[model samples]
Target: MPASLSVETAAPLASAADRLRQIAASTVRPDLLGRIDAASRTLADATVRVVVVGQFKQGKSSLVNALVAADVCPVDDIVATAVPTEVRWGQQVSAALVTTLTEDARTIRTPIAPDQLRRLVTERSGAPGAIGTLHAEVTLPRAALAGGLVLVDTPGVGRGNARAATNLTLLPDADAIVMVSDATQELTDPELRFLQQAAALCGRVTFVLSKHDLQHQWRSIHDADREHLADADVDARIIPTSAFLHSVALRDQTPGSRERSGIDQLAAHLQGPVRADVVTQRQLAAAEEIVAVGRLLAMVAQSELDVLLDPASGGVVVHDLERAQKTAEQLTQRSARWQQTLADGVEELIADVDFDLRDRLRKVGREAERLIDSSDPGRSWEQIGAWLADSVTQAVSDNFVWAHERSLHLAGVVADHFSLDGRAALPELSLAGTDQALRAVGGLDFIGSGRLGIGKKLMIGLKGSYGGVLMFGLMTSLAGMALVNPLSLAAGLVVGTFAYRQDAQTRLDGRRAEAKAAVRRLIDEAIFQVGKEARDRSISSKRVLREHFVGVGESFKQSLAESVRLAKRGADMPKPERQLRVERLTADLAELRALCEQAASFSTAHASVALRSAS
Candidate 1:
């Protein structure tokens, strides 16, 4: 019942969305606005995804089942969840198999018998083909699922690289993460690492210590885990739970058993703060959208109001509109100040990125050289190569991320140059394509593999020994000693060792040079690719702003023309008729102004609430 009733908690958000829809319809088309329709749909759908993730055999599935009061996810000691399982509210029990036909290009949903869910989700069943199933969505008429809460059971961490990647990728979309771990052990290193990444991506995470009933020392374990999380600087709440106990309590309807199981507290937290925050964010976003629409409407109304209240203001309005039109035209000119700023900014950005990359590679080269001087290249080259690849990848990602942030910041600067009042909202810029460009530069394959066959090492050693014998044996011959004498042998031994060391150092230096060259090539390629993208995005942003202002100028002109027509008509009308028309317009203006104030108040109130919650 709590779950069914939770849907009512989002009434404020729903009302806000409806109010925004009405405002958008009267002013701008709802479909024309970005993020408004999407926010509205989110409010309407009311789905909050809480993904349950953990290591294999950590009782994640059992925990999810207890939370939802449904045996939707398959649980076993040996077999594990291969595909994600989504459990949501439905009138009757039903299930669907969602299959991906092409990564994300297409998907096919097929209705399946609920009994087939376990087999399809398990790796042992092998139900998924080569192009595996994406996930299975199961629907049930449970109270917890009634408020549009979708519980996701993801494959455990530490399964494999593919599974780990999938888990990490899912974090960005999850509204909250319930990290399940057994009470028998403290958090492992890998789990801590995963938590750090998940915290970065999701922002809201809760640690669930499972199997509390089995582990008599769960309290100690929970405290230790809390300490561990604190030391690791992970800000998350930890709740100890016993899924088996919770399940029993639900089945038996035992008094106080629910509270003892700790599932009730977890559920309440999810239904209360988690759900409230989701709704509040959506409400605030919708309020902003409404306010944006109201601003535009108010601008038009104010123009009319000004003319009616003071007929002399009509000329001033027209002049302002004409000036706005001229400014919009200038925005498109190549010689505009903003265009020049963009050109200069991009040139500086490219130089900074190139310099930063080269500097990073130089450091890596120095480290590699130090290691080469200490050991044979064939022995430790693999480690050096791996380190270089990781370092370069991280450096490239950082540079690209920095470029993206800078590009957006620069776009704002350009917007300021175009704005007559210097307060106009800049068009939102998207540099998402730049990320793909950085990835296209590929990994450090040019660094070459460190795996050197024994045959190559042997040949190098033999060549060094041959040189040592030829040079040292001749020196000994000058001392009147046989070529095979002990003196010749001793000289050859020392020379051979020195030659071997020299050869290794030379090869190592050569490889290091090659690695540096490869890194430089990659950096240049990235600069060409990412620099072009930044330039294109800059141009695109300018065009978008230009078009937006151009539209605004047209709207202002039309409003002024209509105002002139109305004023002329009023001058010719009878006094009583003109008075009535003026009164009607006055009332409409008052109502529009009130609506604008209300939208602004909504934003302010929501913002205050958010600040309080954050604090």
Candidate 2:
């Protein structure tokens, strides 16, 4: 179950926002009005998405069902999930299947009964219309989901499975990922690798050991899994759960059973710590917006106050504002240093990202060839193939993470160029779309069958032995009395054994070489495909940053121009009217000060909360 922001936390932020909103309305200042309104709307509409992913038949769907206390995601023993299902809060229970038709390739979403979910989201034998289903959306009126906690149940990761690639696409948007595994065993190497990758991508990962009731040694396994996490340096909390126990607890109203199930603790942790992070981030963002608006508001009020207090000073104030206005207006100009910094940074970033990806893929190729040389690919080809795919996936993911970080760094550099005071809020860069960019690249295709069948091996052995027998046995027969004598037969037999061994070695060598070539091809293809998409995304990011900062600059210019107008107008008023205007300005400044204090206070409270949680 997902947790919503606590009422205690939400109340104060909402109160501060309401105050800010009233001020926006009263001031009728366009800059303050729009920023406040947008911040408030973003806060109200914020949702935290927690995506659950795991290997096949790991009870991922069951865990989701238990959390929501509803069968929103279909589960079965044999068939596994083939599509992602999103479970979020709704007033009524409803489900829809999203699919794309083959002919027109147009996406169509159709409403379906909850019971139809099992058929619609499963493999092969699924319902007729579920053929091209992309994903399923399920909504319920569960209290756990009411707080904007969206639970996405994704297809499991499995060997040579297309679902693994599909699951990778969801990593970008996930606020958190719950990697589910059953209590039957500790985390496997692949699962541990995935946890590392998930942590890198989403920054928040929770490992859940499910089916706790069935495994007597699950507790021991849980401890072992913790050790594995420590060894891998993957910071994730592993919770052991029993969906069976959860279901029973729900039916029997047994608190003890629920407690033992660990579901309650899982829910609390998500709602408390996990949900707190999301809320805190939003709180701080809204606060920043509110504080910025406050500053702008106070600026307007202060300029008018100066004009109202001293008519002689009004001209000086307006002149200063006009100068500031010119600088701000230049921020939006094409020749601005920030724009130049952004353009240069983007080009540099693109080159670095391309180089980084190529370097990574080259390493993957080398590792692939090394593995091929180390083992007989004929017997280990499938494992090698899976490893290659996973390795490439990892390399690509790491590259994307690096690119995302660099993009943020570039934004900061641009911000530094724009900020006169060396402090400016870097607008959020839209770098999460790299997942979509990678999604365009296909998974590695399986290379040649390394297995040379017994028949072919025997044939090669016989072909090689035919010449060996004639040469060795004839030479031996010359030393003996007859061609079919014991010495001749022994010579042929020994030669045949030698021929089989040599032929087998030759075949193994050929397969290894073939495997190496295929792996290199795959790596090259990945680099080309992934590199192009990454550059495209980089260009897109550049455009977004350019537009965003330009807008910010324009806003600043507008605010300054308006402030100048207010000061000039105030200077022309009569003495009595000037006094009244000063009083009004004084009151607005006081309100703005209070709002800013509230923002600071909220940040302090959350900071303390975070510290305590960490401790």
Candidate 3:
């Protein structure tokens, strides 16, 4: 996207497909051409989402605007982004507001004036059309976005903030992440932790230090930041930039200023590693499909050509293909090794994930009990309740992250037995949006003020002691003794003291019991809600793998059967006509082999070369 890096850097992917399409058209089978066209469309429509996240007022929006060289995202002095703003490619500058009445409701996209973005995206009360606003979106005709690179500007993140959780949700869908921080200081603990998380979720995380022009000591800060990253074990490239300079460069049309702004270099990384990686992945996937089709067609042509050249050997050729067809058929069976592995893996995952959730909750429950013991639940319930909620939320989040990752590992295991490439397109498991599942756990119903008060305790004590005094006084008077005797008076005093102690102890024990029960109930509900969510996601992933691998097996079986049919048909031809057919078959086989080689080349070597060249 920089002036130095030509737009032609993005052209290789399209060019490769064009060359392949020409060859595919020459093939006799209609399905071959259709497959290549569909792949090309998928590649063309693919968008690389680069999510930008950072602490509040770190110039995140400014970095986004500078990267695209457009005032798409609104910048502010005091307030920060409240909702995500997605800036992507369009023929003309346009903005839209995405809204929904509730989390589960369908989204509505309404067009808005470009200038209205600031009011909608920033923290503003009573702004028109701001109610139920989910996120803001803008599109421009900037060349930086021409290759389907989308820039997401997210709300600032802080420790334990829901905004941070929201940012985590974005990482699963992001192709790359840019973490913005100003050069006023080195990395903070929270920022380091966030970087580690972003790296795990999306490996293409780049650290960008904004406001470089304002910090005279930025180089020292950069050095310290690198060391902090090394100590934290977060892998990211740190780039320093001055968004102010970039804005000035654009206004003055000065390339030198733009280069000094460091925006150009950052843009190059996106255009190079970030955009190029997306292209490479799509290209490899398309190549895999092409090669598979080519191999099948070549098999049919080669078999038919064998029969045409040697008419007497037609029977043997058909027999060999029939044998191969049976082998392919076995792959489609329920008893296949891959199918068995998938079933076992899913079962193991369900049990393990449930246990993991319970273990995490058990630890949280113990910690809650400790807090309750340290202070009276009646007075400190507010603080304790907040702590409990945050702790449980964290445990649930960590458990889900583990489940999602394990599911991916299981998919790779199945791919080993199913695919010749020994790889799988990472299954699109719906791992994000756990807010609903988390809410399903409900809240604890512990009445912290449930214990008896002083007035009630006094009343209960009097009632019990009064009965004891009346019975003892009557007994003493029946013995012709005055009720005011020392024996009677002593007995009355002891009963009253005993009654008061018993009542107080009972109330205190009951409150503790009630609090413990509530804690247990909360933990149980969390286990049920989050555990069920994990299992559902696991089932969805299993179904995807089952459908994909079974389809591949079926294709193989069909191709082999077609090869057998072609061989038999060629054998029945007259000798004179067979001679003419052999020549055409031979040429087609050679062409198919050549195409397979080209596809293989694209799948393996071209991607890394593109990265290096773009750099």
The better-scoring model by lDDT among 1 and 3 is 3
Model 3 misplaced stretches (Cα beyond 4 Å) = 1-34, 42-46, 55-57, 69-71, 74-82, 98-108, 115-135, 158-166, 182-190, 211-221, 242-261, 371-390, 419-430, 442-522, 603-615
Best-to-worst order by TM-score is 2, 3, 1
| Residue pairs that clash (backbone atoms under 3 angstroms), model 1 | none
Q: Model 2: per-residue lDDT, tens digit, 582-602? A: 888898889888888887676
User: What is candidate 1's lDDT per residue for 320-402, written digit by digit as tens?
Assistant: 65565565556556676766776787667666656665565566556656665565455555665556554444444345445
* Ranking of predictions according to lDDT: 2, 3, 1
Candidate 2: give the clashing pairs. Answer: none
Query: How much does candidate 3 score in TM-score?
Result: 0.76
* Stretches of model 1 off by over 4 angstroms after superposition: 1-45, 99-104, 124-133, 231-233, 252-257, 328-581, 610-615
- Judged by whole-model lDDT over C-alpha atoms, candidate 2 comes out at 0.78
Q: How accurate is candidate 1 locally (lDDT)?
A: 0.65
Better of 2 and 3 by lDDT: 2
Check candidate 3 and list the clashing pairs.
Answer: none
Off by over 4 Å in 2: 1-12, 22-31, 45-48, 98-108, 125-133, 158-175, 201-204, 231-235, 251-255, 418-423, 429-493, 612-615
Better of 1 and 2 by TM-score: 2
lDDT of each: 0.65, 0.78, 0.76
TM-score of each: 0.65, 0.86, 0.76
